[model samples]
Target: MTEVDIATKAPESDAQQDSSTNEPTDASQQMGEHEHCVTDRPTPAGQGSTGEIIKLNGVDVYISKPTDYPHTPSRLLLLLTGGTGIKSTNNQIQADIYASEGFLVLMPDLFGGEKAPGGKDTYFADNSTSLLEQVKLKAVEIAKSFMIDMWLARITEAKIMPILHKVIEAAHEEYADAIKYGEGIYAVGYCVGGRYVLLLAKGSHEAGNDEESGMVKAGPYIKAGALAHAASVTPDDFKNLQAPLSLVCVENDALFTDEVRKVGEDIMTQDNLEHEVQVYPGVPHGFAVTGQYQESAIMDAQVTAYEQMLAWVKDH
Candidate 1:
């Protein structure tokens, strides 16, 4: 597998200087001119606890624990939200749900908390938009895959990977006791977040083979990963996936079409990797996190996807 030197340390550059000079007070300040940033809004109160907002590497992440946390979580779940950004109610709901299930959920605002490039109001109010509109918007987003891929590439190289390293480092330090005895760290992401899940899995895989790889030294602690309605992922992304992975896709999702699914399946099978790819019929992209369950069929699919993710984490 060909590896990109993501961990290479270079002399301080102008971008580094800019980040230091313009420290973000809120999530919005984290966007660069060419980068897409999700807008900041009042996140709904996470169930039970509102969650603690902590800054790591100058980026803000909300950490929430189960109210009934038995002082020991089975694993730490790094929940990466889709392109809509981290503060969305949809994202909060998923985090709360995971926490309720006894997992420590850490959600970092990957877009630096800024509203995405198109505008600040691009996001629909959670549980407010009609299912029809949700489906249409998802399709539109998928149509822009080329542009989104470019944006993702730039952000991943410039910010996402480094922030990931820091988040893992922080999690180990903050939850030292729980992680020390827990099953291990795991990652779950939706849409664009899915792309990141693959990246981490690949990095973990590379690091496992080469102890000198920067990922091993940084210690992300990710034992396995799962992604749903992933976008902009190609076969190359899975080349170095070291841990077990589960991919949950919606049959009708434009971003994760049959062709994309085939590529993933073929590569993993050829490589003899431990992984599973599941596609649910008729559901659209964003079903796992944003699907309104008014329809019984959609509700069942969403429930199944979530269960699959939880099961994958446990099994691995």
Candidate 2:
């Protein structure tokens, strides 16, 4: 395991009005303008770290930098939170782990600043809510009405891709200096976010392969990607993937089954694209994030996944 220095700092607060937060006055007007606010922030208590939050394009991104590094970081990892949204403690733990590994980590709010659709309380339900629960909350009627695949389809079409574009642009602008020397840009997604990571890799290639679609591309910047216990990815999703991809799957996961993994693998193989699929035995869907159950096993899997992700990014 990589050693990380832990530091504490008082949170900084800054107030800035971003046009993106304003209500649109006319149809001709763009929905939102680019704006960002930086606030000194610390990692969740017990994590022993400090960083900042950047409000960009109307979304809050939690950024953490590695401490006691001998040299500047050469890579950036954009972490996408699962369905429960960015406020979950599980996400924070993963963020701290990634930051400790010496890469600049930025986590974007997947809900795009909205109150999660079905109601935040009903969705999250409890601190122990697993990745599957967040995506399929029993208390939320809407979640029950739609199947996971359909829900992911709608989310990918409506929110995930668009928000990803905004976040990428904001990261480029906000971290321009630090990114200058960075070797490459990478992404890691959990649960629903995992599907988005696949979409980004696919979309990047799609924008180049198909001109008529007019889709925004994440290809030029993101060179590698990984997904942990990802939900709702299908064979069709991998048709245009252009980057090296690694998938960390759990054997006990109900959402991403063996068949689902096969679908992605088959597609990548046919295309002769670079990809890897590692299935860890006896763990659930949110094994990498939530630490409520199967503590020892889950923790082990999380570490292995993190190491795999870092190695994949560097190798690519």
Candidate 3:
């Protein structure tokens, strides 16, 4: 599509004010317009360690930096939190793990401080010897906890994407030593966050492809992207996917079913987009972030997914 077409179709600016917090959300604010405020934020007691919370362009971000690295970390990872929101203990722990692996991980609060109902304890699988039964039990719990439509209405692509764009722009400026604009930046998303990652990748490609008259100079918003058990993804998302993409799915996820996944994969293959998909057996949606990690099966699948994502990001 032409630059004009892309510009016209681009999402309108996000809501002028956040509905949940009534805070001004001026996503276009210049990075240098305000100084960043870094505060020692603590996660719930005994949950795990999360990096400090920093404000960038009006967004609250949880950033974890790897320590004791021989050299400065070159990779910048934008982690999108699931519907559990950014403050979930599991989400923070996940960020910490990524940081330990030498990634500068930034997880923004997609929900502007409004609490999400389900959290780390959402997994409802009991000692069901049958994997199918376990998946069903987990699905029921997730459906009960998450009001998907309401949350989707509140955090539409139009509402969240601009905020994310500004967050990234500010991140490039804030972490200039470690991350250069359009270089070495990657994203990983879970559940709702996964869908956002796909949008980010699509946006990066559409904006970058139009070199002469693009909105900004043609460059990637994110170098590559990965997702686990992404919710609300459609086959259309794969039509013109640009960046290298990877997906980790559970075999029995209601959100990301086998048929839907196949359709998307077909589209990506037809477009010849560089991408990979791996579906682990006998787990439900949210297996990566919200799974019952105490279970050996769930823990193994989650670890494998994380490793797959890390390998893909590094390879790309």
Candidate 4:
């Protein structure tokens, strides 16, 4: 088997979010991935408790625990919202995959925690439009309510980007203070979340080492990222990413099927960015999750990615 271990210090990846230029708070990244996780305890040796909705400065965030976890400090993952949105994210099939492997998956509700059962969503090209429109509209309300500049205030945030950054910091803080669930972390983002991960990536500059060539000597921090079906990010949009990063795409998706994907690949490669790009065969846009008509190769590809990710974490 061709084992593609994407970096040194073990794991790595990189990301970005949104077309409109808006500034949000910074999100921190941590290191560590595990084969098992612990439950029924305060932060055990390498295990931390997950599964709770956190309120950081008034932002309500939700984290889902991985199933059948073996118990380790902590592992983190993300699912960015795209159009038509991923209504509810506690799906056993999806949640257990990482939890069983020892991860605390954060399915943040960028959109007020509205839960959806599931189904088909092909005709809506405005996939993220649902949430994006929300932020746009909310900006107005926030400005009116708080008496501030609409666009400027919106960029400063109370929305998705800020919430995401806060979540990262909150994860770091929780593990730091918690008696359990305190291992390292890595993030996985899809669509909007994928884009949001990049924002976290950009944040590396402020936190130091945005490319995340390896783990910071300080300790277990979110060390890498895996962005699936990501959106575009200009160099200036986000901070420097310190974590190693990956961007995955389904072969049939028009958004990144050709030149666009290559451009993203080129930027990372030229920068000697710690990252990888995998385009699974015969899969459409949201192949990793539901969205019907998914290919087995795509599913296997995800498994391979996580395995490689675990390996990278160990090395780090």
In model 3, state the lDDT of residue 280.
89
Which model scores highest in lDDT?
Answer: 3
What digit string (tens of lDDT, one per residue) describes model 1 on residues 151-246? Answer: 666665346666776777777777765576555778998877888888877643334443322445533347888998787677788676676789
Residue lDDT tens for model 2, 1-316:
0112111210000012123323222211110100000111223345543556778777788777778542664457788866656665556667767777767788888776543332212111233545465344333434332433344455654556656667777777776654565655688887778877787676354454333334455554477888887866676777878877999986745557688788789988988888998998855455565343323555577678878876887677
For residues 167-216, what per-residue lDDT tens digits would candidate 3 score against the true structure? 77787778765566226679999877888888777633445433332235
**Candidate 3: C-alpha lDDT:** 0.64
Q: Find the 10 residues in a row with the least total lDDT in model 3.
A: 30-39
TM-score attained by model 1? 0.69
lDDT of each: 0.63, 0.59, 0.64, 0.44
Report the Cα RMSD per candidate: 14.1, 14.1, 15.3, 15.2
Clashes of each: 9, 0, 0, 54
Which regions of candidate 2 are displaced past 4 Å?
A: 1-45, 68-71, 115-154, 203-221
User: Which is better, 2 or 3, measured by lDDT?
Assistant: 3
Cα RMSD for candidate 2? 14.1
TM-score of predicted model 4?
A: 0.55
lDDT of 4 at 29: 10
Q: Which stretches of model 1 miss by more than 4 angstroms?
A: 1-49, 117-154, 203-221, 290-293
Candidate that would win on TM-score: 3
